[model samples]
Target: MIVEHAVLRVRPGQAAAFETAMAKARPLVTVQQGFLSIEVRPSCDDPEIYLLLIGWDRIESHRDGFRQSPDYPHWRALLHHFYDPMPVVNYYGRSIFHD
Candidate 1:
């Protein structure tokens, strides 16, 4: 499996709206092929910052499959505007250490 990680920096005072949007946007991504699971968490140090972790079957599942799908636009519309500087997404391979 592959792990997709991104730190979302939301605009000030938009955390609640962003979380609502994310919840609405979840179905768009979850319906894609190769999707595994996703988790979103707010930072303890900074509430404006959120951690987005997604599990996929492969890197292409996100970059090529989901991003290229018809649902992408809806997903973007729902959640993209809340971002300040925008998030930087990265992918990771299987973990070397885990419980």
Candidate 2:
């Protein structure tokens, strides 16, 4: 499996709005092929920072499948504006220590 990670720095005072928009945008990604799950968490130290983790069967499932899909525009429209600077996304493979 692959894990996509992003540290979203939302505009100050817009965390609530961002979270609400994320909730609405969740379904867009969830319906994609190879999508497993997603978790969005707010930072305790920095209110404007959010951690987005999404599980996928492969990296291409996100880089190609979702990003190329028509749903991407809707997802981008809903949440992209809340970001102060664009988020940098990274992908990880399974943990080496995992059984």
Candidate 3:
């Protein structure tokens, strides 16, 4: 599995707007191929920071396939404005972790 982690720092006073946008925007992932699951969590220490965690079957499923789809443009239009300075997205594969 591929793990994609993004830290979204919303602009001040735009938290509600960002959350509402995400509610409408997140479904785009479901329509695409190779989607596993996703989670969005608000930071306890920083209210403006949101943690976006997504799991994909393969890295290409998101990095290549999803970005190439026409829907991404619409997705970008809907959510890109919410970022303060734009979030940095990082990807990783399982190395070692257990519960």
Candidate 4:
């Protein structure tokens, strides 16, 4: 599996709205072709930060598939505005030790 990771730095006073929007946005990703799973967690050290992890079948599944899907606009609309400086996403392949 491929893991997509991002550290979302939400703007101050936007956490509650961001979480609500995320709930509405989850379905947009779930219907994608190669989606495996997704998780969003708030940081213990900073309430305005969140960790986003999405599992996909391959890198192309996210880069070419979901990013090009019709639902992407909706996803962007629901969540993108909440970011302060925007997040940088990274991808990881299968674990080195977990096999």
Alpha carbon lDDT of residue 31, candidate 4?
90
TM-score of each candidate?
0.97, 0.97, 0.93, 0.97
What are the per-model numbers of colliding residue pairs?
0, 0, 0, 0
10 residues in a row with least lDDT, candidate 4 = 90-99
**Count of backbone collisions within predicted model 4:** 0
- Tens-digit lDDT track for model 4 on 1-99? 999999999999999999999999999999999999999999999999999999999999999999999999999999999998999999999898965
Which candidate leads the pack in lDDT?
A: 4
Error of 1 at 24 (Å): 0.3
- Local accuracy of candidate 2 as per-residue lDDT tens digits, 1-99: 899999999999999898889999999999999999999999999999999999999999999999999999999999999997999999999899967
Candidate 2 clashing pairs?
A: none
Worst 10 residues of 3 by lDDT: 90-99
User: Candidate 2's C-alpha lDDT?
Assistant: 0.96
Q: Name the regions of candidate 1 deviating beyond 4 angstroms.
A: none
- Which residue pairs does candidate 1 place in steric collision? none
- The 0-to-1 C-alpha lDDT of every candidate, in the order given, reads 0.96, 0.96, 0.89, 0.97
Residue 5 Cα positional deviation in candidate 4, in Å, after optimal superposition: 0.3
Question: Could you tell me which 10 consecutive residues in candidate 2 have the lowest summed lDDT?
Answer: 90-99
